[model samples]
Target: MSERVLIPRNRGFLFLDSHPAGCERLVTDMWQACPGSADMPEGDGPVALIIGSSAGYGLAATLAGLKRAGIRGIMVSFEKAPTERRTGTAGWYRTAATADIARAAGRDLVFLNGDAFSDTMKNQVADLIEQRFGGRLDYLIYSVAAPRRTDPATGTTYASVLKPIGRANRTKTLVFDGEGVPEVREVETGPAEGDDVEQTVAVMGGTDWERWIDQLVGRGLLADGFATAALSYIGSPLTAAIYRQGTIGTAKAHLEATARSLNERLGRTVGGRAVTSVNGAAVTQSSTAIPGIALYTGLLRGVLGEDLVPPVHQLAALWDQLTGAAPSDLDDEGRIRLDTWELTDDVQAAVAERWEAATTDSIADLADLAWFRSEVQRLYGFSVPGIDYAAAVATDIPWPDHTA
Candidate 1:
């Protein structure tokens, strides 16, 4: 086995083979957090179809659906295959590990690897549902994060930008060197221009999500009284400029509007519900790449302390919300509030104090840099407990029969 080194790029860590033990540990943690089968309502649980179900919140929801509700599922993702010189992405291994666990428990799992935005992929999923699962899906979860998207109708490509809307906003950013030391540097981003917001919306907004729902309904793949949701976030004020009030924010605003339209359409057409769940901020591969978010996450962890929630925990909460066991907790706009605790007054006050005091010298004391770094490492399937780092693991693992 060659020496495994953590390479820090501007975005996030790049690594080779995943620690199989770590992958297994992730599955174990998810199950431990899951609701038991007996706790669920009587019946073979709902049939769930998850888009972008390879990593981050999407993957967590997939695990939660199977373990918590005993639901059969189909996952759609776009990931690379392993090569002789390199291992596949961490998501590939995570999915493989999850499939093994689900199969052992007698749960049905199907994985589709392709561009979810393409028409071909949509047709394939609809056909598979018709042939395999009796042509009816009860749930749909959309959680895709991509830098660029190619429109299937026009074949035009649009890219998402992470700039503030009106003016150049100056802020401090933390850049890690893969050695646990982070340097704080002042950075500034110019405003978006020249249809930048439009492009971002075209790529990351709710159009693709609405399209998926429409296609599924048109093919009669969605069962009556089905439910659908797409993930969104409204973070702390510190990140509002670049995130919530920026180009991405414009896209999100559009997404929220679409959710309202979808709710009405789903309710009338299939006696179903559609919602956009506002989630808490967590360290994800995409979040780490944003300009000011890493610094904000470190401070948030410092203030929230043990109250900080990971993706798995958030998914568990979502399960409880979706199952009608608890209150739906809808806000004035009719969007679900899964992030209410994160946006509390006391938590924001402490984060604000630390945000002002944050600097290169004060970061070590004011922010939870260690926790942030560990989460980033975990995203790449490293820094996990009980993993033999020196083992010569096979790079290419076969996909499950259903997915293959």
Candidate 2:
């Protein structure tokens, strides 16, 4: 096994082997909170399909569906397999670990590894639903985060940009040195160009989500009263210039618009509904890639205190919304605001105050950078409790038979 090393100053961790015990602990927590858990609502869970289900919110939703909602899951993701040089992406290990646990409990889970944006992957999932889950899925969860997307028809690839929409915004960005010491630097991001908005939208917007729904409907893979949700995020005003009002935000707006259209169409056609879910920020592989988000997350978590919800807890809240245990609290645009707690007036106010006062010297005291760093490591199956990090393990574990 390759040696596991932590990047300096809390950037992240690197290793070739996943901690089996860590994976088990993570999934076990998810399972214990699942539908059958004492706190969950009782009912027969729906048959569900999730795109981008290997990591982040998608993984949480998948686990919530299986454990809390008691549903059979069909998960799709684009992830690397284990190779001689490195272990597979954390999602690969997570899926494998979760599958073993689910099967032991007599649950059904299917993981399809490939590009979810392609027609080929969509068709494969449709077929799998028919073959394995008796032809219909009750829930479709779209939680993919990609930097670029290839158009299925024209084969043109569009990449997403993370620039502000107007003039450049310079702000104090934080980074950890190789030794784990925090340093603050002023980072400037320029405005988006003429085609940047369009390109970003084309890559990250709801176009593919709509296509997936349309194809599934056309193929009769959706059950009556089916529901679909795609994840989005709206940050606080502190980072609005770069995040909420930026190029990616334009794409998110398009996504919400598509959700509105799909909701009406699905309601009219199949008595189903579709909605966009605005989720709270958390540490994930995707979010870590976005500039300024890490600092924002740390500040937000510090302000929110223990009330902050992680991805798993957020998915639990979503399950509550879907199962009618909790109210949907639909916005005027017909979207669901799962970030309700995070966006509370008190929380934003506190974060805003810290945002203004934050500096290299003050950040460590004002924000939860410790928590942020630990979570980043956790995402990669590192720094987890109960794992013998020194143990020798194989990098190339075979995919479960169902996934294979």
Candidate 3:
């Protein structure tokens, strides 16, 4: 893959096919960003399974967990195509790079290429776990992100529609890159509420998570005391309606509810536990498309550093807690609001204060600009310490071979 032009503030969207060394360098930087030090855990047999194990924080959490614990396991991912309309490819390049890093670290890695939503894929995963790990797994992580899914049994596909809630929402958001913020008006001229809500739930919420867990248990493949978790997000109230209260919010609610149900069901066999991590906002490919979040994220970047814990950091912290290395930072419901650092009353209050005071005339200042750039760089495998961007990138690295 050829190197892409790097924009000053929008490096987060660079989306390069990073080389093995570059990927490992960033992984190490993020590993140090966590609190405390723990040896990589040593054990065997399906120690961990990460669904949606390809990009963004999903990939980060997997690497961090493995690095910290020194555990090895399988990764089942439904990799998505890059937004550039890359033809006939779905993130194999990334999987290959990550595999190279894992092998170098003396960690065992397995990458299964298939849809996690289908029975064929689900059964395939169960067989792999059962055969390789003695029908038991210590950890299961659900981190897939997509717009929609077609239910194999129901023959109905679930999808999402982005729109305004409550009185024609008019808001300002960051533009294409992180350079500037712009005013936007969200209009809802699409489907009706019932249709949209159902579709959103079907596409983005807990059903798939529940199905995967159920399949594992029924196949007698889950080991005792297995722990499972799914990632969720609840931004500030300003953006909550668009994120947490709209179609996506409805899906998250279902996801949270699913966690409760799964925890109950897994009580005996594996002491099944369900956790929801309300992560902070980052400059991910998906978050950049959301309305009104960029400005808030930018504001957060300025205030959060120097003892600041963003979403990715929180994810690493939470992974540590899950693996029995640290205590949890959970709320009353046992679900951790990891995003609290960015959503704190003080933090949100400060950002809201900035929002109201900001106009097209008075946009973000140098502080905000600096924060935006740093956070943006952190998103796309850059700006993190110890990574040499000048390193050569290779796209032909070998993918993990579980069969061998």
Candidate maximizing lDDT: 1
Candidate 3 RMSD to the real structure: 4.0
How accurate locally, in lDDT, is each candidate? Answer: 0.81, 0.80, 0.67
**Shift in Å, residue 61, candidate 1:** 0.5
**Deviation in Å, model 3, residue 369 alpha carbon:** 3.0
Q: Which candidate should be chosen as best, given TM-score against the real structure? A: 1
TM-score of 1: 0.94
Model 2, runs deviating above 4 Å: 1-24, 33-44
Give the per-residue Cα lDDT of candidate 3 at 122.
86
Write model 3 residue lDDT over 1-404, tens digit each, in one string.
63343222334345443333444555555555544444544554237888887766677666666666665677877753433323112245456556766777667777888887888888887887777666677788888888778898887777776654443455666543344343333323332365787787887789999898888878877767778889888888878657777777888889999988888878855776878877777766677767677766765665565545644467677777787767878888778777776766887777777776655445655126655655555545445556555654433444557777
lDDT of 1 at 144: 90
lDDT of 3: 0.67
What tens digits encode model 1's per-residue C-alpha lDDT throughout 1-404? 33333332324344545554465566666666665552434566678889998788998888877766677868998887666666667787778888887777777879888899999999998998898888899888899989999999999999999989989888878887655578787899999999999999998899999999889988988798888889999898988998999999899998899999999998998898888889999988889878878998999999887888777777767767776657788889988888888899999899889888888889999889988887877776776767666665555766556844
Minimal lDDT window, size 10, model 1 = 1-10
Query: Which lDDT tens digits does candidate 2 get at residues 265-319?
Result: 9999889899998898888888877677888888988887678877787887787
Could you give the candidate ranking by TM-score, starting with the highest? 1, 2, 3
Q: Each model's number of backbone clashes? A: 0, 6, 9
